[model samples]
Target: MKPPRSLLVITVTAVCLLASQGAATWLLVEQSRTAALATAGQTVKRTLGTAAANINRGFLQVDALLSGLESLVAPSESADPAGPNRKLRNLSDQNFLVRELMIVGADGQVVASGLEATRRHPPALKSSLLADDALPHGGLLHGGLPHGGLPHGGLIVGDPLRNRLTGEWSLYVGRAGRWKNEPVVVVAEIPLSNIAQLALPETTTAGLRVSLERTNGQLLMSNPHDARNTGQILGPVSDRLTPGGPWAVVEGRVSGRRVIGAATPALHEGLILVAQLTEEEALADWRETRRVVLIASAALAAVVVLLAVGAVLYLRARDRAAASLRWSKRLLDQALDSMSEGLAVYDANWTLVLTNRRYVEIFPHLRDVAVPGTPFERLARHAAAVVLPAGTGAEREAWAEWRRRAHEGSESFEQTFPSGLTVQSTQAEMPDGGIVSVHRDVTAAKRAEEHLRAARDTAERANRMKSEFLSNMSHELRTPLNAIIGFAEVLERNGAVPEAVRIDYARDIRLSGEHLLAIINDVLDMSKLDAGAMILHESVCDLRRLVGAAGNMLREQARAAGVLLRVMIPEEPLPVLGDERLLRQVVLNLVSNAIKFTGRGGTVDVAVVRAEAGGLQVTVIDNGVGIAPEHLPNIFQPFYQVDGTASRQRGGTGLGLPISRAIMKMHDGQLEITSAPGVGTIAVVILPAVRCAASPADEVA
Candidate 1:
C-alpha cells in the first residue's frame, strides 16, 4: 500500500522540473516584451530625427536668401544714401516671395520702404539690435510680416552689415510671403499644410492625420480632416520644447485611437519637429508576432515537461544508489580523530573542512576562533607556525625544498626542525574535491636514537682508556725492574761463597718482585687516568738528543734478541715544547715495539728527521716475521695485538701503541703506521711546530 521510493523520488523531481520550466516561460515572455518596447522606441526616434533634419535644412535655405539680399546694398559709401535705399526697396518688390524690405538709417529714420511709407517707422528693431542678445533674430514672429494685407510667414534671415571701408553695420531684411505677394505680420499664417501632406503620402490609412504646432499652443498647419480640437497640446513635445528661431512642429492621430507623439529641435532654430502614430496602427502587426511566439512557447513547455519527468526518474535512482554507500563515512571520521598525528581535510580551495583532535591539540589557539571551513589555505599560514634557528642556513632551505616537492606531486615527505622535531607528512586527495593531510611527530624517536649512539661511543672510549693505562704502567715499572734484575745477576756471577744457592735466590727474587711491581704500577696509572688527575710535565727538549737517548735505552734489549739495532739522527738541533717525560716514554715504546716484533736475526732502525713541511718525523722500522694484512689495521687498538700470546711471551702489555698515541696527541702530534704481510713495519710520529725556550735539564734543575 506504500508508494515505492522510486515513485516518491520521481514525484519530488517532477515538482522541481515543473518549477524550472515555469521560470523559463516567464523569462521568455519578459524578453519578448523588452524587445517590443525597444523596437517601438527606436522607430519613433528615427522618424523624428529625419523630420528634424528636413526642417533645419528648409529654415536655413530661407535664411540664406535673406542674407544674399542684404549684401546687395551696403549703405556706407552711397553717393546718395536715400537714392540707394529707394533702389533696394524696388529690388524687394521684384520677387513674389519677398513681402517687404526696408532701409533704416543710423538716426533711426525709416529712410525707405517697400510697404506704405507711414507704416515703416521703427518700433523695437533699433533697441533689439543694440542689446547684448544673439544676432539677426529672424524666425516665426507670431504676428506675421508687413504689407499688402495677406499673411506672410516662413523664415526671416537678417544680417547687420558693415561697409568694407567704414566699420558700422546696417540692417538688410528679406522675407517669405504667405501667398504669392500678399504680406501678413503673423508667422502662423504660413501654410504648413504642405509639410503635413508630405508626412504621410498615398499609402497612409484613410483616418490618419498629421499636424504641426508652434511652441505657443497655436496650430500652424494640419491635414483638413484632423480638425478635432485636442483640448490641449498633447504628449511630451509641447511642454518640453525650447524657444528660438528655425524649428519645426509635427503632431497627429491614427484611426482616432490612442495618441502618440515625438518632437525634435531644428539645427538652425530652436523650433521642434513633432510626430505621432496612434495605437490602432502601431499594434496592427503585434497580434501576429504574439500568436507565433505564444504557440511556440506552449509547444516548448510540453517537450520540456516530458523530458523533465524522465530525468527525474533517472536522478532518483542515482540518489538511492549513492545513499546505499554511506557505510564507511563514520569509520573514516573516527579514524582521523583517533590518530595521534595531526590530521586535517581541505576542500578544493584548500580551506580546512575538518581537523582532527591531534591538530586541535597541536594548535590550541585555533579552538578559540571560528573553525576554518573547507580550505586549509584560508587558515593561518604554515610558515608562520614553523621556525628555524639562525646560522642554520641549511634548515631554512628545507622549506623551499618542501614547496618544490609539493608542487611536483611528491605526496609524502619528511622534514626536521631545528627544535629537533622530525615530522613525516602525507597529502591525500579526497573524492569531494579536497585534500587530506596527515602529519606524524618523530621528535622522541630521533632523540632516543641519538642517546643510544652516545652510549656505545662512551663504552668504547672507557675500554680504550683502560688498556692505555695498563700499557703505560707496565712500561714504567718494567724499566726499573730490568735494572734490578741485571744487578742481581752480576752479583751471582762473582764466583764467591756458595754460587748455586746465590743464583737460585737471585732468580726467584728477580722474577717474583718484577712481576708484582709491574702489576702494582699498571693498576696505579689506570686509576690516575680514570680519575682525570693525570698531569703533564712540560719542558723544552732537543729532539735529536731524545731520539739518541731512546735508541740507547732499547739497544741492549735489541742486542739480547739478536736483532740489529740502528739509529738515524737529524744534524740540526730540533727544538720542541712538551712533557719531556711523556715524549721520552713515547720514543721508548716505539723502539720497544720494534724490538719485540723483530725476528732473531732481523733488523730494527729508528730515524729522526726535520720533516720537510714544518714538522718533525721519527720513524721506527722493523723487519720481523711481519704482521698480517688484517692484523695490521687494528694493531694500535688497545688490547689488540697481531699475536696476543706471543706478545705476552716477548714482554708486551698489548697497549704500547695506544699509550704512544695518547702521549703524542697530548703533545699535538699523531702516530701513523704502515705494514705488509711479509715486509717490515713502519711507525712514524709527526709533531706540529712549537717554540722551545729552555733545555729540559735547565728547566727541571
Candidate 2:
C-alpha cells in the first residue's frame, strides 16, 4: 500500500520545488494545456467546415446532372433498347464519379444496361426504388434510401451495390417516373471511392480522424478510404454532431481514447462532416513545456543538495586521510622490525609506495632506489639486472616490463635471485587501489622436493618395467611353448594311439611351434631395430604377390573370428625395391592386428594401389572395435596397449606395430594407422616412389 521509495522521494522533492515557485508555475502549466486544446479545437472546426463544403460541392454536381436525367431518361426501351443503352453509356462516360447508369422497369427488370447486360450479372433495379411510391417527384432528395447509402441531396440514393461482372461497388441513385403511362426507373451507379475522394481535403493534416457519418452516428465513408470502417456505428462522440444544427467543438471519448472534435452543419440530410484530434496529440506542446519547467526546477534543487553533500564528504575524507597516514606509519615500523618475509607495496600507478627493510636486504643492489614515490619500473629493472646478469639489454628490459606488469596486476609468482635463492611471492590488493606483496624464501624446500620426486620416479619406473615384462613375456611365450610340449608328450607317450588322433596331435604341435617362433622373432626384430642393427635388403619384389601371401596366411584366422578378410590386387606385377622378408612381416602384422581387433561380422579389406606420392601402397582397413584417439599416437611404441592389463582376451606384446613401422622407415616408406573408438581403423603402408622398381610413379598416399 506504500509508495515506492524512489517515487516517494521524487514526490517530496517536486512538492518542495513547487512550493518555492508558488502558484505561478502551476497556473502557467494549466494555461498552456488550455491554449493547446483550444488551438486544436479551432483547427478541427476549420478542417470540418472545409471537408463539408468539399463534399457538398461534389454532390451538388451530381444533383444537377440527375435533375437533367429525369426528363432525358424515359421508357425508350419499349422502342429501341440498344439506342437508349448507347445514349446512357455516352452520358455516364462523361463523368469520372459515376460507374454506370441503367434504366429499369416497374418489374425490377433491367430495361437497358448502359454498359452491358448478360445472364450472369444483370443490372436489375433494387425493389426499394421500384416498390416505393414516394411523395416527391424525384423521391426524398436527402433521406437515406431504403436499399442502403448515406443520404445525398439528389435523386433517391439506394444501397451500395457491387457489379457482379466487374466486382465494382457503387451507390445506386434512381429517379422514378411514368413514361407513356408505364412505370420506368432511371438509376445512376456511383463509385464509393469517388465519394470518399470528394469528402477528403485536398491537403491532409496529421492527427486528424476525418470521416463522413450519418446523423445517427453510423459511418458512411472515411476520408482515409477505409472500406472496413464503412457502415460501422460510430462512437457516442459522433452522436453529439447535429447534421443541420450549429457546429461546436466538444470534449468526449471516441473508441476508448479522449479526443477534441468538431462537426459542420448538414452536408446532406442524415449526414455530418466530423474531424477528431486525440487528447495526446492536442496536449503534446503543453506536455513538452511542462517537462522543461519541471526539469529546470529539479536541477536547481539538485545543485543545492550536491553542494551540501560535497562539503560533508570533503570533511570526512580529510579526517580519514589523517587517520590512515598514522596507521600506515605504525604498520610500516612493525613490519620492518618483526616480519621475516620481504614485503613491498605499490600504488595504482605502479610507483613504489613503501618497502620493509627485509625487502631491501633481499635485493641489496636495489636498496638505494627502492624508496617511496620511486616508479616501480626503475626498481624492477634494477632487480631484473641483478637476477639476470648474463642476459642482454633487450632481454633484461623485457623482464623488467613483465615484472612491473605483474606487480600492478597483483599477480602471485615465483622468482630466483642472483644468490640462487628461490623466493615465492604473493600479492594482495589494498582498498585504495594499491598492491601489497610478500616474498618468502623457498629454495631449501624446493631442493628437498626435487630430490624426493626424482627418487620416487626412478622407483616407479623400475616397478612398472618389471611388472610388464614378467606378465606379458611369461604369458605370451609360455602359452604356445606349453602347448607344443604337451602335444608332443601326448604323441610320444601313446604309441597305440589311432592314426587320426596321432596326426591331429602332430598338427597341433607344429602349429604351437610356429606361434611361439613368431612371438620370439618379433621381440628380437624389435630389439635389432631399436639398436639400429636392422637394415633393408633392397631387392625388386612383387608387392602385390606379397600382400596376397599375407592375406592367405590370415584368411583362416579371419574366418574363425567371423570377420570377412578381402584382398584386392592388380593383376600386373607391382615391383618394389624393399626387403621382401621384412615387408611380408609388416603386412602380416597389420593384417593379423586387424583380425584381432575387429568384432564378429565386421570386415577387413586389403588392397594394393599406386601411391599418389609415386610408389605402391598396401591399404588395410577394418571395421573393428577401434583403437581410441588417445592411444593412436603412441600405438607404434613398443609394448604399448590401450588397455595394458595382462588378463585382456586379445593377445599381443604390442610390438607388432612398432616393429612394422620401424621396418617401413628403413625402406623409406610410411605406415600410418588412423582409427576411432567403436567405429573402424585404416592402416596405410606407403612405399616411397624412388623405392618402387621400374617406375617412380607407382604409389598412393
Which 10 consecutive residues of model 2 have the lowest summed lDDT? 134-143
Q: Which candidate is the best by TM-score?
A: 2
Tens-place lDDT digits, model 1, residues 250-314? 23332434533555555543234555555445545555566676687678767766776677667
User: Candidate 1: misplaced stretches above 4 Å?
Assistant: 1-340, 346-438, 443-447, 450-501, 504-508, 515-519, 530-532, 538-540, 571-577, 625-651, 691-701
lDDT of each: 0.57, 0.73
lDDT of 2 by residue, 194-225 (tens): 87667664644566767766565656566666
Worst 10 residues of 1 by lDDT: 182-191
lDDT of 2: 0.73
